[model samples]
Target: MQLKEFSFICPVIESAVVLKAIETVTSPDAIAQTLGNTDSVEERKRKLPSQLVVCLIIAMSLWSSDSMGTVLKNLVNGLSRQWTKLGQYWKVPNSLSISAARQRVGCRVMSQLFERVVRPLATEETPGAFLGELRVYYSYR
Candidate 1:
């Protein structure tokens, strides 16, 4: 179905609010500042601002998948299809590639992205209830 034709069963938070929150937290400037004085080569890739990489990692974490293999499988069977429909970038990677990328990218980058983007976009009490609950539940588990 076209994105415009799909509707949530419940009240939905505004995408603008979520995007704005992401922008506020993950601003290029903020990322740059975080990378400052760091010797890591991964930090230099900030010049690219890889939305696909960030989205995949966040998706994996949100889905409560325990391993990169599971994450990659889910991405191929689930998220990639949606992303393709939305005209967003998505790719299926082998387990080894997924592991390599995850290791190279590291949790620090994902943590910072979550802190800056997803955290603020979360509901006032928590923004998207199901999403928030899932995140909290998965995080502790």
Candidate 2:
């Protein structure tokens, strides 16, 4: 029998690609506004600032099957240099810290983020987006 190296590519979307697409749709100003509106902005800088947490929450959704730590790592790893200012002492937070940061931000931040950025992709004439004369929406709640 011949031996060959085994390799498999993950089906999960790359963090950089998704983050770029998301950033394009949701501007930094929009994110800041949402965080401010929800009163979830951090008072002091930390490893996971409120802005970073907001992005982390968004990245979490894209990588649902991944652990929070993994999602966070992927997000930080994918960010551009300007997004972070650490030299070399920073490290990925443990699961508990990530959870704490998320809790501090709370549900309102996520809700506000959605409200500020989410918009209907279909227009009145788009097929299948409407049912008869009414517009159809996918309700998660």
Candidate 3:
């Protein structure tokens, strides 16, 4: 069949349901609430803001393709754009900077952020149908 002859549009009902589900999963308030409780002070120096760092960590997690090197590379490529958008308050760390940040904050912070933000986002029932598919495909195997 020719490309033009085939229907390309998704059904409106499915699309609306899917979109609403996605919105619930990625809601900003959910993100803020999840990251809000992170400790803000360490060794008497201010740490990166929990909310901002959580945002960065989430982006990094999404970009990572199964390796630390890949995550660093993706962070470098998108760093400038993200920094520009987030303003001076958000610093895009270099390779060394990432190493330092990781050392300073440790893995616990990132792990907590993931559990708080990404986990809930994945589990919200409105979004569960799509996430169920992903879990079956990626997690169950």
Say which candidate scores most in TM-score: 2
Q: How many backbone clashes does candidate 3 have?
A: 0
- TM-score on alpha carbons, each prediction: 0.38, 0.76, 0.38
Worst 10 residues of 3 by lDDT: 1-10
lDDT of 3: 0.43
Output the lDDT of residue 78, model 2.
Answer: 77
lDDT for each of the candidates? 0.45, 0.75, 0.43
Model 1: runs farther than 4 Å from truth? 1-50, 65-91, 119-141
lDDT of 1 at 111: 66
TM-score of structure candidate 3: 0.38
Q: For candidate 3, lDDT tens digit of each residue in 1-141?
A: 212232226433233233233234444455445444455324443334333344445555444443544554343344434222344454444566555555655566656545654542233354443654564223421
Give the range where candidate 2 is weakest over 10 consecutive residues by summed lDDT: 1-10
Give the better candidate number (1 or 2) by TM-score: 2
- Against the correct fold, how does model 1 do in TM-score? 0.38
Model 2, span 1-141: residue lDDT tens: 101121124455455567676566666778788888888888887888887888888888878888998887777777765555555777888989999998999998888788877777678877788998889976543
lDDT of 1 by residue, 5-107 (tens): 3334436534433333333444545544443423223544432133434545655544453565554444444432323243335445566666566565566
